[model samples]
Target: MINKMQILSLTALGNLDAYIRYANSWPMLSAEEEKLLAERLYYNGDLDAAKTLILSHLRFVIHISRNYSGYGLPQADLIQEGNIGLMKSIRRFNPEVGVRLVSFAVHWIKSEIHEYVLRNWRIVKVATTKSQRKLFFNLRKTKQRLGWFNENELRIVAQELGVCSEDVREMECRMSAQDISFNPFPDDESSDRKLTTVMTHLRDNTSDFANGVEEDNWEMHATNKLTNALRILDKRSRHIIRARWLNENNKITLQEIANGYGISAERVRQLEKNAMKKLRTAIEA
Candidate 1:
């Protein structure tokens, strides 16, 4: 029988091929051998027995993680999460249940990998609600080809998943959108990659010139409107609004402003409300 240290060393350093070979080489234990090991771990709290159970199932986790590689997560990371699941399953395994450890561990392994994929696949999560999660996994299976969903297809998916049609449309939009790079590099023009080089395109003379003119005009218009609005307000009202709303860390409670000005809090609140209403009417006019 292999020792615990030897088994862990093998799992840590072993390649996928080597681990598969090791799993295949180990003869399936007799029912008595399995029962003794499980009892030792569960009843006697034997670490060695637990290690043996986990080592034997590492290859099973690897096999399960491979099925989820289509989601673009690293295979090694997926396998690591699956191994956590396998350990949990081993910790809870019952020899009296009459089923092999592999059968019980499959659920645990896949559950861990599924969570990892959903979390790391996008910046904003693709699935929030339970119905959306079900649709996210099953929508690929329902679609025959890679095109946008038509109204008929949308209705079918919504009905099958027991969600509204608009929910289906929202989820589909989230799923179809790809993440865009903010400041891409110049040498990334490979045929295999989708992101464009931001520096190369943004440095174009025509685009820069046009954007500069548009930005200057907008700034001038905004400055004129602000100046006009300030002229319409009395000095104290203008000062209150500016300090409260225009400062960098701008928002203060009415009580805070009241304390600062040595006035009643209710009076401060009334002033603030009147100031906001006046600003709105001024902006509209």
Candidate 2:
């Protein structure tokens, strides 16, 4: 359940400078105060405690959101997404855990911001693969300066990112490309100047019956392969993977699943990792 105070914060986000100032005005909670509030929320499901925790952490969200300003997205929207992540982290926080809330919340905060950047960065979506996504963010900072990379610089970047040079080159090209409208309006003088709109030469491929049938067959084949792969796993590993990842609306934490099975959270994590490895091998086969 989301706190009402966060909903109020969303309204103030329209004026970003004022929102930042408002967020900074909230006092930071001391270690004892934070732990007590976390315990209340975690153990008792206290919504008031949740509200307090979120209000205090608003400034931290702003600080993290500022780091992604290069993506050309609005600052207010980034803060709003980071706020959602903060709320999610609070919901799952365990006071018994040794780490501080700020330390634990950083991962959730950055994760939400990363998703926002990728979704809005381009119309065509630049980075789909895992390696390409890593390259997309780091490539800009790793480059020496403006302009395209030479061969030596490309090799250096690939080594840094643990990807082949070709991957880095491809990501660089994708990042440099700009989005164009499929059908653009012509200028007032176009007829005399012989200027033509893009729609004039555009071809529609949606009516190709063979291509549509092929796509449907591929999707059905992938789904069947995944079902078969899951069937091969041990019961416990299969449940862990489904609970943690497959249930998108409500993903269970490792600690929660561990408590049910009488094991440590670390053990649950290990099982999840191994299960994913096996599933990948099966699917690829």
Instruction: Give candidate 2's total backbone clashes.
Output: 0
lDDT of 2: 0.86
Tens digits of lDDT, candidate 2, 1-285? 566455546634467777777778889999999999999889888888888888899899999988898888988888888888888898888999878898999989988888888999999999877667777878867763635888988887888888899988888989889999864656666466665677788788768988889999999999899899999899999999999988999999999999999999999999999999999999999
TM-score (C-alpha) between model 1 and the true structure: 0.55
Model 1, range 53-73, lDDT digits (tens) per residue?
777667777778877777877
Give each model a TM-score: 0.55, 0.66
Kindly report which residue pairs in candidate 1 clash with one another. Answer: none
Give the deviation of candidate 1 from the true structure as CA RMSD: 9.8
Q: How close is candidate 2 to the true structure, as a TM-score?
A: 0.66
